[model samples]
Target: MKKMLVLMLTLTMVLAISACGGKAKESTTESTQQPTTKTEEAAATEEEFLPEPGAKLVVWSSGTEKVLVDEAAKAFKEKYGIDVEFQEVGPDKSIERMTTDGPAGVGADVFLAVHDRIGSAVQSGIILPNDYHEEETKANNSDKAIEALTIDNILYGYPNSVETTAVFYNKDLVPEAPKTWDDVIKFAKTFNDPKKQKYAYMWENGNGYWNFGFLGGYGAYVFGKDGSDPSDIGLNNEGGVEAMKFYQSLKNTVLPLKTADITSDIKKSLFTEGKLAMNVSGPWDTISLKEAVKNLGVMEYPTLPNGQPMKPFSGVKAFLVNANTKYPNAAKLFANLITSEEFQIKDFELLGNLPSNKKAAENDKIKNDPFASVFLKQFENSVPMPKIQQMNAFWSVHEATFTSIWNDGVDPKVALDDMVKKMQDSIASSK
Candidate 1:
């Protein structure tokens, strides 16, 4: 899936003191001693910790946030006289590391990732609730952003980035961005020139994300339970069906050049080359879009015939701690430092990511940036991506089934039935 909602949990992954207690003591002692050579000590301290005496922390991140995480760690050490160690790892591996590899040794005291992983992370019983928000923090950020990262009424991560699916169009081809999905379809059917080298939109691989957005426009929801309850499935409901039908109707009209290959770069290239007039994308590609095309325009995915703007699932990336970390207090401080307005705002400006910190949004640096703010607005009505583990099972069969209906001449009813059955089977197998 192009934009499968990534869920990150606060790992607070402390190794069992018994398991690595010996190594930790040695590492701590070494971390405190000044090396004989100043340059060597400086470089080593730069990578390891520069604690005042013996303060130490470990962090795991996606590596994209390396600079930000590192700077924050450095600041924490300077301010509180603590030493911090950091590692780079993707969200999936982070989860595996926490659950299967953490307690033994070599695990992070805190983890940084997205919100969608909360269910599985919590189910794994290795994450702890966060208690860092001030009243001002909640007031500045969207309530939904806060709620999305929260599980079991306990917030486990400090939401760091805001993401949503919005319409990105070329101003050269279209006079103005359409206000609704119906308008989008109408525009595609009316203006697209297949024989001439233009398309109204591009179909990546499947319509899950697009359909998910449309379902919201029609007042529909998937998984029914806001990730807190993982057993429920909402894909078979009326809204889901309607959303699917809408996507099926667009098969030939305005899809991308490579309908079967849902790769993002390919889709962006088509749009940039003037083959695609519009597509749904997030802040991840804002910079590339601007560099690829001139006069790029953005608009909310308009409502279905029902008058609701497509409330796409917003992605929430956050910093989490490992529950098993030996340095729980230090880990909490580190998580707090990462989410602080200074580091988060700087990251938002540098990366074009919508800031998760409430105060970061108001920073003068990003207040007027069009690309950043558009994504920020999408968060207003955005729903959190469902964080169920069964979601993986559903996705495995989703593309094939969706392709069958939209491209391979399969009946919608039959296709949906197979999808439901396959998903149910996956759920059973997982249990």
Candidate 2:
């Protein structure tokens, strides 16, 4: 099934590219001829086609999301009489496997994916185009969450959860959350003790995903605001260089550790051990942090020195139906059921995931939760991570650029300029 879909997609692309070349005149003539009204009506009728019942369905999710998907599957089975199976598959591995399994007719009917993967999945023809519950989904989810799942103006998935990094502080060490970057720097200067392994704040500064907040806060962005224009790269601009300079200054000034020393494991260990006062992380750390720290407090990311809020990249996790699935209706139903407001609220209660559903987010339980509220506030200032395939090239370049500045002592401007050039080259090659 997936193989056929890929073949069709490849042929479509080939024809499109060819049409732009020597066949432009012929293709234009064919395209300009309007379809008959009867033909259009027939296409509309076919769009409403539904799959048969009693088809067994399989779903894949990460281990952390297993319980949520399992509960959803149970509810879906009861309501629709469709037998559903749930499997633990990490998001990255799921996308990778779909490239092979989908084409072979053995892929799960539904699978979880981060919003950023939508572009690649669509390009590969692995995920189906969603035409179910469009209005309900738009009305229920946050605009950014909805935007995340949209590729070239078509919805591809049902958003389940939305996440962005925020500041998590140890209440015992910091009486209150720092309000601004300068405040954080001052607090770090007074609180950090390299000799005692204590620090005021720490994050994986070398990681571009985490560092993007600072760059974005200062008017630097990976692409344009809409994230569609790859030619307008912003990472090496004046604001970006300034952000990098600030990031570089932290290594030996406010932060006692180097960028290479701030791996996620090390950061988690330090924070969990009460040696770190504050750490920038996402919801995935909530459970472990709560268990390790007696008094854990969450807050919106601090304001930058320029008085602008730190703009983290928001990532939406959604359920995507396999394009090649035999049970299209069942898969769509299951996807819709799992991302519904009720299930989103249940997921929040069970796993502390921040729901993409606006109604679920407005529930008293989530609205009143101190930890959850902070993330909600941060989301207001966050930017959706770009869904363009060019973004795939951006990640490695971002990492290398930051690593050079922080670890290799390369000049920030030089590193950024080189990084952007490399990124543009990569984007061209990817095309």
Q: Using TM-score as the measure, which candidate wins?
A: 2
Whole-model lDDT per candidate: 0.71, 0.86
* lDDT tens digits, residue span 213-293, model 1: 765665555565564343566665676667667767666655634445656776777788887888778886777788888
Query: Residue 217 of model 1: what lDDT?
Result: 66
Q: What shift in Å separates residue 401 of candidate 2 from its native position after superposition?
A: 1.2
Q: Pull out the clashing pairs in model 2.
A: 3-103
Q: Point out the worst 10-residue segment of candidate 2 by lDDT.
A: 45-54
The numbered model that scores best in lDDT is 2
lDDT of 2 by residue, 1-431 (tens): 99999999999999988878867788778866745586685556545644465588999999988898889878877766777888888776787688789989999999998888788888999998778668768888988888888887898889999989998999999988889888889898888998988988888887888988988898888888678789899988999898888888888767766678888888888898888999889987887789899999998888877778888888999999998899888888788889999999998888889999988999999999988888888888888889987888887677778888988889989999999899999988887
Candidate 2 displacement at residue 317 in angstroms: 0.9
Error of 1 at 110 (Å): 2.7
